[model samples]
Target: MSDSQRFPVAAHALAYMAHKGAFSPAQAAPSALLAASVPTNPVVVRRVTALLAKAGLIATRPGATGGSWLLRQPEDIRLDEVLKAVNGCAHIGSPPAGAKGCPISEHIPRQVGKALTAADEAATEALSKITIADLLDENPVSLAAYTPHASCPVAA
Candidate 1:
Protein backbone atom coordinates (compact mmCIF):
# COMPACT_ATOMS: atom_id res chain seq x y z
CA MET A 1 0.00 0.00 0.00
CA SER A 2 1.12 3.56 -0.70
CA ASP A 3 2.01 5.90 2.13
CA SER A 4 -0.76 8.19 0.95
CA GLN A 5 -3.50 5.59 1.30
CA ARG A 6 -5.07 7.23 4.31
CA PHE A 7 -8.45 5.67 3.79
CA PRO A 8 -7.19 2.12 4.15
CA VAL A 9 -4.94 3.03 7.04
CA ALA A 10 -7.70 4.83 8.87
CA ALA A 11 -10.16 2.09 8.09
CA HIS A 12 -7.74 -0.49 9.44
CA ALA A 13 -7.22 1.56 12.56
CA LEU A 14 -10.97 1.80 13.13
CA ALA A 15 -11.52 -1.87 12.44
CA TYR A 16 -8.80 -2.72 14.91
CA MET A 17 -10.52 -0.60 17.50
CA ALA A 18 -13.83 -2.22 16.71
CA HIS A 19 -12.26 -5.62 17.17
CA LYS A 20 -10.05 -5.08 20.19
CA GLY A 21 -11.81 -2.25 21.97
CA ALA A 22 -14.86 -4.46 22.23
CA PHE A 23 -12.99 -6.46 24.84
CA SER A 24 -11.62 -3.54 26.82
CA PRO A 25 -13.59 -2.58 29.90
CA ALA A 26 -13.44 1.08 28.80
CA GLN A 27 -14.22 0.18 25.23
CA ALA A 28 -10.99 2.01 24.38
CA ALA A 29 -7.74 0.84 22.79
CA PRO A 30 -4.31 2.44 23.05
CA SER A 31 -2.70 4.20 20.08
CA ALA A 32 0.41 2.02 20.22
CA LEU A 33 -1.81 -1.01 20.01
CA LEU A 34 -3.75 0.57 17.19
CA ALA A 35 -0.50 1.40 15.36
CA ALA A 36 0.63 -2.18 15.67
CA SER A 37 -2.49 -3.32 13.88
CA VAL A 38 -2.00 -0.69 11.16
CA PRO A 39 1.69 -1.66 10.99
CA THR A 40 2.30 2.07 11.21
CA ASN A 41 3.78 4.53 13.64
CA PRO A 42 1.94 5.65 16.76
CA VAL A 43 1.96 9.20 15.40
CA VAL A 44 -0.04 8.19 12.38
CA VAL A 45 -2.51 6.31 14.53
CA ARG A 46 -2.83 9.33 16.81
CA ARG A 47 -3.38 11.63 13.83
CA VAL A 48 -6.21 9.55 12.42
CA THR A 49 -7.62 8.98 15.88
CA ALA A 50 -7.79 12.74 16.33
CA LEU A 51 -9.67 13.04 13.05
CA LEU A 52 -12.15 10.33 14.12
CA ALA A 53 -12.58 12.02 17.47
CA LYS A 54 -13.18 15.43 15.91
CA ALA A 55 -15.76 13.90 13.58
CA GLY A 56 -17.51 12.34 16.59
CA LEU A 57 -17.03 8.88 15.15
CA ILE A 58 -14.71 8.02 18.01
CA ALA A 59 -13.72 9.36 21.39
CA THR A 60 -10.22 9.86 22.83
CA ARG A 61 -9.03 10.09 26.38
CA PRO A 62 -5.61 11.43 27.40
CA GLY A 63 -2.88 10.22 29.78
CA ALA A 64 -1.77 6.78 30.85
CA THR A 65 -5.25 5.42 31.44
CA GLY A 66 -6.67 7.06 28.31
CA GLY A 67 -7.04 5.76 24.78
CA SER A 68 -9.40 5.84 21.80
CA TRP A 69 -12.68 4.05 21.15
CA LEU A 70 -15.62 4.20 18.78
CA LEU A 71 -18.22 6.77 19.71
CA ARG A 72 -20.81 5.61 17.22
CA GLN A 73 -21.93 2.06 16.82
CA PRO A 74 -20.39 0.18 13.90
CA GLU A 75 -23.75 0.06 12.14
CA ASP A 76 -24.14 3.82 12.38
CA ILE A 77 -20.69 4.92 11.21
CA ARG A 78 -20.41 4.93 7.43
CA LEU A 79 -17.14 4.54 5.51
CA ASP A 80 -17.73 7.81 3.69
CA GLU A 81 -18.02 9.61 7.00
CA VAL A 82 -14.69 8.19 8.08
CA LEU A 83 -13.08 9.05 4.75
CA LYS A 84 -14.30 12.61 4.95
CA ALA A 85 -13.16 12.86 8.54
CA VAL A 86 -9.68 11.81 7.52
CA ASN A 87 -9.72 13.71 4.18
CA GLY A 88 -8.95 10.33 2.72
CA CYS A 89 -9.53 9.38 -0.91
CA ALA A 90 -12.59 11.50 -1.71
CA HIS A 91 -10.54 13.93 -3.79
CA ILE A 92 -10.42 12.42 -7.27
CA GLY A 93 -7.00 13.87 -8.06
CA SER A 94 -6.32 17.59 -8.26
CA PRO A 95 -7.90 19.50 -11.15
CA PRO A 96 -5.58 20.13 -14.08
CA ALA A 97 -3.20 23.05 -13.50
CA GLY A 98 -1.04 22.80 -16.58
CA ALA A 99 -0.20 25.47 -19.17
CA LYS A 100 -2.12 28.40 -17.71
CA GLY A 101 -1.42 30.51 -20.83
CA CYS A 102 -2.72 27.87 -23.26
CA PRO A 103 -6.28 27.92 -24.53
CA ILE A 104 -6.68 24.25 -23.67
CA SER A 105 -5.82 24.88 -20.03
CA GLU A 106 -8.96 26.90 -19.34
CA HIS A 107 -11.35 24.45 -20.99
CA ILE A 108 -9.48 21.37 -19.77
CA PRO A 109 -9.55 22.40 -16.14
CA ARG A 110 -13.25 23.29 -16.15
CA GLN A 111 -14.30 20.08 -17.86
CA VAL A 112 -12.01 17.85 -15.84
CA GLY A 113 -13.08 19.46 -12.59
CA LYS A 114 -16.71 18.88 -13.42
CA ALA A 115 -16.12 15.27 -14.36
CA LEU A 116 -13.94 14.54 -11.34
CA THR A 117 -16.38 16.20 -8.97
CA ALA A 118 -19.21 14.08 -10.26
CA ALA A 119 -17.11 10.94 -9.92
CA ASP A 120 -16.06 11.86 -6.42
CA GLU A 121 -19.65 12.44 -5.35
CA ALA A 122 -20.74 9.14 -6.80
CA ALA A 123 -17.89 7.30 -5.07
CA THR A 124 -18.74 8.95 -1.78
CA GLU A 125 -22.36 7.91 -2.19
CA ALA A 126 -21.34 4.31 -2.75
CA LEU A 127 -19.07 4.43 0.31
CA SER A 128 -21.89 5.85 2.41
CA LYS A 129 -23.95 2.73 1.89
CA ILE A 130 -21.33 0.68 3.69
CA THR A 131 -21.30 1.04 7.43
CA ILE A 132 -18.47 -0.15 9.66
CA ALA A 133 -20.74 -3.04 10.62
CA ASP A 134 -20.92 -4.06 6.97
CA LEU A 135 -17.13 -4.06 6.83
CA LEU A 136 -16.96 -6.38 9.83
CA ASP A 137 -16.14 -9.93 8.81
CA GLU A 138 -18.14 -11.24 11.76
CA ASN A 139 -21.72 -10.93 12.88
CA PRO A 140 -23.11 -7.54 13.84
CA VAL A 141 -22.64 -6.44 17.42
CA SER A 142 -24.16 -4.21 20.02
CA LEU A 143 -21.67 -2.16 22.03
CA ALA A 144 -23.08 -3.24 25.36
CA ALA A 145 -22.45 -6.87 24.60
CA TYR A 146 -19.39 -6.50 22.37
CA THR A 147 -16.47 -8.86 22.68
CA PRO A 148 -13.44 -9.76 20.60
CA HIS A 149 -14.11 -12.65 18.27
CA ALA A 150 -11.41 -15.07 17.18
CA SER A 151 -12.71 -15.52 13.66
CA CYS A 152 -12.81 -11.82 12.92
CA PRO A 153 -9.22 -11.11 13.87
CA VAL A 154 -7.76 -8.08 12.04
CA ALA A 155 -4.35 -8.76 10.49
CA ALA A 156 -1.48 -6.33 10.45
Candidate 2:
Protein backbone atom coordinates (compact mmCIF):
# COMPACT_ATOMS: atom_id res chain seq x y z
CA MET A 1 0.00 0.00 0.00
CA SER A 2 1.05 3.53 -0.58
CA ASP A 3 2.22 5.66 2.32
CA SER A 4 -0.99 7.67 2.12
CA GLN A 5 -3.14 4.55 2.48
CA ARG A 6 -1.66 4.02 5.86
CA PHE A 7 -3.48 5.71 8.70
CA PRO A 8 -1.79 8.57 10.46
CA VAL A 9 0.80 7.59 13.03
CA ALA A 10 -1.08 9.56 15.67
CA ALA A 11 -4.27 7.67 14.94
CA HIS A 12 -2.35 4.44 15.18
CA ALA A 13 -1.00 5.48 18.56
CA LEU A 14 -4.44 6.34 19.86
CA ALA A 15 -5.83 3.07 18.54
CA TYR A 16 -3.01 1.29 20.24
CA MET A 17 -4.03 2.83 23.53
CA ALA A 18 -7.62 1.95 22.87
CA HIS A 19 -6.86 -1.65 22.00
CA LYS A 20 -4.81 -2.05 25.13
CA GLY A 21 -7.75 -0.81 27.21
CA ALA A 22 -5.76 2.33 27.96
CA PHE A 23 -8.35 4.74 26.72
CA SER A 24 -8.68 7.02 29.69
CA PRO A 25 -8.92 10.74 30.11
CA ALA A 26 -5.31 10.84 31.35
CA GLN A 27 -3.57 7.71 30.15
CA ALA A 28 -0.11 8.15 28.72
CA ALA A 29 2.43 5.88 27.03
CA PRO A 30 6.06 6.51 26.37
CA SER A 31 7.06 7.69 22.92
CA ALA A 32 9.44 4.77 22.55
CA LEU A 33 6.74 2.23 23.29
CA LEU A 34 4.29 3.78 20.89
CA ALA A 35 6.98 3.92 18.25
CA ALA A 36 7.77 0.29 18.77
CA SER A 37 4.11 -0.63 18.50
CA VAL A 38 3.86 1.14 15.17
CA PRO A 39 7.32 -0.11 14.15
CA THR A 40 8.28 3.38 13.04
CA ASN A 41 10.88 5.92 14.05
CA PRO A 42 10.28 7.42 17.45
CA VAL A 43 10.67 10.90 16.01
CA VAL A 44 7.74 10.30 13.68
CA VAL A 45 5.66 9.00 16.52
CA ARG A 46 6.61 12.01 18.63
CA ARG A 47 5.57 14.42 15.89
CA VAL A 48 2.15 12.74 15.61
CA THR A 49 1.79 12.49 19.37
CA ALA A 50 2.46 16.18 19.65
CA LEU A 51 -0.25 16.91 17.14
CA LEU A 52 -2.83 14.74 18.91
CA ALA A 53 -1.89 16.25 22.23
CA LYS A 54 -2.42 19.67 20.80
CA ALA A 55 -5.81 18.62 19.45
CA GLY A 56 -6.86 17.39 22.89
CA LEU A 57 -7.11 13.84 21.61
CA ILE A 58 -4.44 12.66 23.98
CA ALA A 59 -2.20 13.93 26.77
CA THR A 60 1.55 13.47 27.15
CA ARG A 61 4.06 13.63 29.97
CA PRO A 62 7.83 13.88 30.25
CA GLY A 63 10.53 11.74 31.89
CA ALA A 64 10.54 8.08 32.90
CA THR A 65 7.17 6.37 33.31
CA GLY A 66 5.73 9.25 31.35
CA GLY A 67 3.50 8.64 28.35
CA SER A 68 0.33 9.70 26.58
CA TRP A 69 -3.28 8.99 27.41
CA LEU A 70 -6.57 9.62 25.75
CA LEU A 71 -8.18 12.84 26.92
CA ARG A 72 -11.67 11.63 26.06
CA GLN A 73 -13.58 8.39 25.67
CA PRO A 74 -13.07 6.43 22.48
CA GLU A 75 -16.68 7.05 21.48
CA ASP A 76 -16.13 10.77 21.90
CA ILE A 77 -13.11 10.81 19.60
CA ARG A 78 -13.90 10.75 15.90
CA LEU A 79 -11.58 9.14 13.39
CA ASP A 80 -11.70 12.24 11.22
CA GLU A 81 -10.22 14.33 14.00
CA VAL A 82 -7.29 11.96 14.29
CA LEU A 83 -6.86 11.84 10.52
CA LYS A 84 -7.03 15.63 10.23
CA ALA A 85 -4.53 16.06 13.03
CA VAL A 86 -2.00 14.03 11.07
CA ASN A 87 -3.03 14.79 7.53
CA GLY A 88 -3.91 18.41 6.97
CA CYS A 89 -4.95 17.92 3.36
CA ALA A 90 -8.26 16.28 2.51
CA HIS A 91 -7.55 15.40 -1.09
CA ILE A 92 -5.03 12.63 -1.64
CA GLY A 93 -4.30 13.31 -5.29
CA SER A 94 -2.97 16.48 -6.89
CA PRO A 95 -4.52 17.96 -9.97
CA PRO A 96 -2.63 19.96 -12.57
CA ALA A 97 -2.02 23.43 -11.20
CA GLY A 98 -3.12 26.72 -12.77
CA ALA A 99 -5.94 27.31 -15.25
CA LYS A 100 -3.87 28.80 -18.04
CA GLY A 101 -3.71 25.65 -20.18
CA CYS A 102 -6.69 24.76 -22.37
CA PRO A 103 -5.73 21.25 -23.44
CA ILE A 104 -8.75 18.99 -23.88
CA SER A 105 -11.86 20.63 -22.35
CA GLU A 106 -11.05 23.53 -20.03
CA HIS A 107 -13.86 22.56 -17.68
CA ILE A 108 -12.95 18.87 -17.64
CA PRO A 109 -10.01 19.08 -15.28
CA ARG A 110 -11.77 21.59 -13.09
CA GLN A 111 -14.82 19.33 -12.85
CA VAL A 112 -12.63 16.32 -12.16
CA GLY A 113 -10.81 18.20 -9.44
CA LYS A 114 -14.09 19.20 -7.92
CA ALA A 115 -15.27 15.62 -7.99
CA LEU A 116 -12.05 14.47 -6.36
CA THR A 117 -12.43 17.07 -3.68
CA ALA A 118 -15.98 15.94 -3.07
CA ALA A 119 -14.85 12.35 -2.83
CA ASP A 120 -12.20 13.29 -0.33
CA GLU A 121 -14.77 15.17 1.70
CA ALA A 122 -17.04 12.17 1.57
CA ALA A 123 -14.25 9.98 2.87
CA THR A 124 -13.59 12.39 5.72
CA GLU A 125 -17.29 12.43 6.47
CA ALA A 126 -17.35 8.65 6.58
CA LEU A 127 -14.44 8.68 8.96
CA SER A 128 -16.28 11.17 11.11
CA LYS A 129 -19.01 8.58 11.54
CA ILE A 130 -16.54 6.19 13.12
CA THR A 131 -14.91 6.49 16.51
CA ILE A 132 -12.16 4.74 18.38
CA ALA A 133 -14.95 2.84 20.06
CA ASP A 134 -15.97 1.41 16.72
CA LEU A 135 -12.40 0.27 16.23
CA LEU A 136 -12.39 -1.39 19.62
CA ASP A 137 -15.55 -3.27 18.77
CA GLU A 138 -13.79 -4.87 15.84
CA ASN A 139 -12.07 -7.63 17.81
CA PRO A 140 -9.52 -5.40 19.51
CA VAL A 141 -7.26 -5.34 16.51
CA SER A 142 -4.20 -3.13 16.36
CA LEU A 143 -2.54 -1.14 13.61
CA ALA A 144 -0.44 -4.25 13.20
CA ALA A 145 -3.49 -6.04 11.79
CA TYR A 146 -3.46 -3.69 8.83
CA THR A 147 0.21 -4.32 8.04
CA PRO A 148 0.98 -6.23 4.90
CA HIS A 149 1.83 -9.86 5.23
CA ALA A 150 5.51 -10.80 5.24
CA SER A 151 5.19 -12.76 1.99
CA CYS A 152 3.05 -12.22 -1.07
CA PRO A 153 1.06 -15.33 -1.85
CA VAL A 154 -0.28 -13.68 -4.99
CA ALA A 155 3.18 -13.82 -6.50
CA ALA A 156 3.23 -17.57 -6.30
Q: Which candidate ranks first by TM-score, i.e. highest?
A: 1
State in Å the error of residue 70, model 2.
0.5
The pairs that clash in candidate 1 are: none
Per-model lDDT: 0.75, 0.72
lDDT of 1 by residue, 63-134 (tens): 777788887677778888988988766565777586867998867888988888898899788778777776
TM-score, structure 1 vs. true: 0.78
For model 1, where is the 10-residue window of minimal lDDT?
A: 139-148
TM-score of 2: 0.74
> Candidate 2: minimum summed lDDT over ten consecutive residues — where?
139-148
Listed per model in order, the count of residue pairs whose N, CA or C atoms clash below 3 Å is: 0, 7
Please identify model 1 stretches exceeding 4 Å from their true place: 1-3, 23-25, 138-156
User: Residues 37-103, candidate 2, lDDT per residue (tens digit)?
Assistant: 8778777777788778888888877667777888788878888888787655466576666466666
